[model samples]
Target chain A: MRIAVVGAGPAGVYSAQELVDAGLSVDVFDKVPAPYGLVRYGVAPDHPKTKRIALALGRTLGNPAVRFFGNVAYGLDLDLRDLLACYHAVVFAVGADDDRLLDVAGEHLWGVGSAAQLVSWYNAHPHADDSFAHTVLAAREVAVVGAGNVALDVARMLVGGPHRLAASDVPERVLDLLARSRVTDVRVIARRGPAQAKFTVPELTELGKLDDVDVVVDPADLAGADDEADSRRARANVELLRGWAERPTGRAARRVHLSFRLRPVAVVGETAVAGLRLDRLGVPSTVPAQAVVRAIGYRGAPLPGVPFDEETGTVRNLGGRVVDATGTVLPRLYVAGWIKRGPSGVIGTNKADAAETVRALLADADGFPAPLKVGPATVPALLRGRGVRFVTWPGWLRLDAYEVALGRSGGRPRVSVDDLATMLAVTRAGDL
Target chain B: MTFVVTSRCVGTKETSCMSVCPVDCIHDIGEQVVIDPVECVDCGACVDVCPVDAIVHEGEADDPSVVADAYRRFGLEAP
Candidate 1:
């Protein structure tokens, strides 16, 4: 059976991997000339280890049973109708790349942006824009609003310094920013107490371990907030946090304050962020800051011609089967990953997630109506007719090797061809 | 004996290995606080987080040094 997986991120690639292992012919499509969507873009550059997921995802796309159509966007170059006509079934694994807004006052101010944008910029994502600089580097202090590992990552990136970041696959320009940064204080603000934080303890511990950076926790904030160390993780987080609070203050250059029980009410600046207005229980207070990062959460955008839940930012699905607004299952359409569920869980979470959807899909495939279009040649013909310059699996490999060659290996991440043109040119050059 | 930190656990030792396993002391995944909330048949935590799901990608559980290094990443004594 032929299957089409839209998107080549962790979700899409994992879905495709499942299909290929089942001895099925699959085609993976992506907007960029390269694949491994967020693994290459969203992951923090300092954590070069996480980016290793790209190597495995890349191997799956190279599988003979799978075909990659890079630079071919789903909504634009091809739609649901086009996919269903060519393949028996389609799986949409598009991850939520859109940033969720803080929805507070003064968010329109110059010094506010999301952690996702900052991450994408440093990772050299093709779509990363310049606003990241204006928002993140606007002042000497950064107020990161959220309680997840992403908040920790942002805290690390902001003041972790160039010497620490240089070892990873970080882009040179981002490394330069860290080196020249005047930012000294990074406050990780959590609306609730530490009990509700989403960061895993070990990752939190890693943030604490950064050289020359002191992770300070206020004992008063812990007592002031309504905190109940209900779960082991929460207890562990609190214990670790208390340890930081009890420790003698260090003579570190930068400090990461794990502040809790404070909810951001406003960005608090006329045209740019100078302070963050916060509410502590009932008390109103403003904390000095230059820029603010909204690391609250992520939401999936509705793909064209697909059923999406606007509220949850997820594709409406039951056990991975696409269900409509009326709760009717849409046949031959399946979903996995963040779109399948809300943006939760880590990279491994998607594996089991994709497996469930694939199980349902395999069961339903026997009854699926065969595609009206025949042969592997149909997709290339259709795309070519639309003037879409797509990159094949081999083409992607050449680009991959090209990038690796351009990298300093142990130092800077491969000089990312942050523009689609360079990626397309690199892939096309290997075509001949 | 519970699972040993193998060479395969190199990169994501914290994110996947420690988090998923219930028995291991270095469970970073305790955001669920202890172990994976989702039930897995023979989940790696069974043997102290094995090469399954995210970590088992290339299945290179062959290197002794790499295994020790992965264990060292979390300050856990390698089996």
Candidate 2:
């Protein structure tokens, strides 16, 4: 059987791996010129360990039975009806691409940004805006409003010194901009206490590793982490928070305050973020800052022909099977990753999620009809007939090699090409 | 019930389990992470975090070949 997997992220690759292992032909599509969705784009540049998963994912895409079609977007390039004709099944593994808004008053201000935009900027994602660098460098103090790993990630990047990100994969220009940043203080504000924080213990404690940065934690906030600690990670986080709280301050030039039980009421500025107003359990206060990064969470947007849940920000599904609002299963359609469930879980979680979706698809395949238009030439011919500049697997390889060669001149791992024109030019030059 | 890193971890050497290992028994030699059975406290932390379900108890390994290959990759003699 032939299958089409949309979005070449962890979920799509993991699902493709399972299908190929089952001796089925799989074709993967992604909107970006390259693969490994968030790993290459959303993950922090200093996080080399987490980004290493790309090695395995790349291997899966390179398999004999699997083909990768990059630079092709769903809904725009091809709708659900188009894919359903050529393949036995289709799996949508598109990740959450949009940021969840805080809905505060001054969120429209010049300096008020989302962690998604900041991440895109540092990682050199094609969607990154040049103006984000200016905002970051211009701020003397930044408030990252959230408690999860994304929140800590922005906090770490903001307070990092000149030489802190030298060895990372961040573009030289972005690194230079960060080196000149005026941000000296970053406050990670959370509505709930530490025990209820979405942050994993390791990520939470990793903030302490920054060079000469004061890891500030309120002694009072440590109580919730200690008193109501429900899990092993919670307990461990409480221990680490207590250590930071007790440590002597004023030894460092930069400070990262881990403040709990604080809710953002407004961004508080006319044209730009001047400060963040907070409500501390009905007590009113404001933390003065030039920039605000809303890192509360990510929300999934509706795909071209997929049934989406507006409330939950997910593809409406019952264990990976796409269902309508009234709970009617749509045949031959599936979803995985952040799109399948809500935006949560680590990278490994996608494996189990994809497995269930694939299992259901396989079971349902027992009573399948014969495919009408299925072959290697079918989809390519269809896309070619329409004027889509779809990138082949070999094309992506050429681009990857060019990126690596560019980075090789410097000592860094790889310098990502953030624009589509350059990427297409590089790949086309190789005649792939 | 010491957790053994298996063949499922070969390609994806996610550091999720390694960073949380209390005894620091998990080591990324080259291809995959290996648990040092000698130092492992068998706390089951690695198993819970492993994304691919590659970790298993010593007695739960049904495929001896898979277990042996994982051990050999880590330069350990399979029991």
Candidate 3:
């Protein structure tokens, strides 16, 4: 049985590994040269321990029955019809890559960027450029909009400073840029009170350990005596935030200001970001800040030939079966992870999502159409014909080696290949 | 316009506004209730579940736009 998993993120890699363990040939494709999508690029570099997932995912890539087709874009390189013709099943584990735009005026101005772009630039996502990141580093203060783990990660990165980032896999360009940043104040503003914050306990706890970072929370911002599950969780998080806030100020430490009940009205700056205009709830008042990074959440793109609900930003499906735009089931197609469900939950949530998709695939395995007979040699020519610049397994291996060598010079584990030319050149030079 | 609750209130069993609504946008806020705006989409599922008879429809009482605006201010998109 042959399956094509479109994406090399946790969902795709895990699903492919599960299918291979169940005795099937799986081809994993990713647009980026590297595997382990968000884990490598979206995650903050200071959290090297959280990045061990990449090493575990590397084992899945090494599977003999599994093939990694890197730098192969889905809609651009090979369309949905092409995958349907070739594989027994096609699973879309593509994540929600698009950032939710802040609808307020002045959001498009300079110094305003999504948490996705910031995380990508620092972690060296190939598509994230240096110019955008430099604009953010130039700011003296930043206000992160939203209360999720990503917001915490961004705030922590801004406050963690150069020493904390040096040993990690952050790009040298990003490090040098951050080293010069005078970012002293990081205010994490949330529209809701503490109880409504989406950050888990462990993530909230990690902020307390940062040496030069002070956590701040106004007592008035705390939720009232509500004992509901959400409120209780918020209370705990607030208690943690308050505990750190009460501590003596650290010498030369940056501040992580946790503000609540504040909705961003607009980003306030003419050329570059100067501040954000925010509406405070209850009393109905407004506030302003120097810079704003909206981290409300991520939303998935409408996949070509897939049933996507625009409101929910998810492909309409039932138990992992792919449905059409009109809700009709598509044969041999499945979906898992964030694309299937709107962006929510953590890494472990993908396991259940993938398991359901796998069950559907296995249940209908006998009905799979015969795959097109294309070997290793035919793939390159076919991709070239389609104008697809797919990085072969060997190409990815070369890029991996090049990154390791680059990292070695800086006394780190790996550096990232941030563009197509450098990655291709490394492969062509037989660097692997 | 005063916002009215529609038919999609299938899963919501508890209404917390009966005691809390200052203008009594809800007639009783306690019992089977209705938003009494002249434009009310009088699908009062909230009426059956309201712990108090505090919900009021448009013609049923005075204007509730001020109270409705409070809900909107909290970032809850008005019904």
Model 1 lDDT per residue over B4-33, tens place: 333333454445454333222334432222
Report clash pairs, candidate 1: A169-A413, B3-B47, B3-B48, B19-B29, B30-B33
Residue-level lDDT of model 2, residues A195-272, one tens digit each, is 888777657767998997999988987764677887766777788888999988988989999999998999898898
**Interface C-alpha root-mean-square deviation, candidates in order:** 8.8, 8.9, 21.8
RMSD to native for every prediction?
7.0, 6.7, 16.3
Instruction: Put the candidates in lDDT order, highest first.
Output: 2, 1, 3
Candidate 3 chain A lDDT trough over 10 residues, lowest sum: A225-234
Error of 1 at A101 (Å): 1.6
Per-residue lDDT over B1-79 for candidate 2, one digit per residue giving the tens place of the 0 to 100 score: 3568887888998877875563456888788888876566544557657788788877678777766765565577777
DockQ of 1: 0.07
**Candidate 1: C-alpha RMSD after superposition:** 7.0
Q: What would the per-residue lDDT of candidate 3 be over residues A90-143, giving only the tens digit for each residue?
A: 999999988898899889888777888888888888788667566666767888
Give one clash count per candidate, in the order shown.
5, 0, 29
Model 3: how far residue A138 lies from native, Å: 1.1
Regions more than 4 Å wrong, model 3: A223-235, A248-253, A282-288, A372-378, A429-432, B1-79
Residue B16, model 1: Cα distance from true site in angstroms: 11
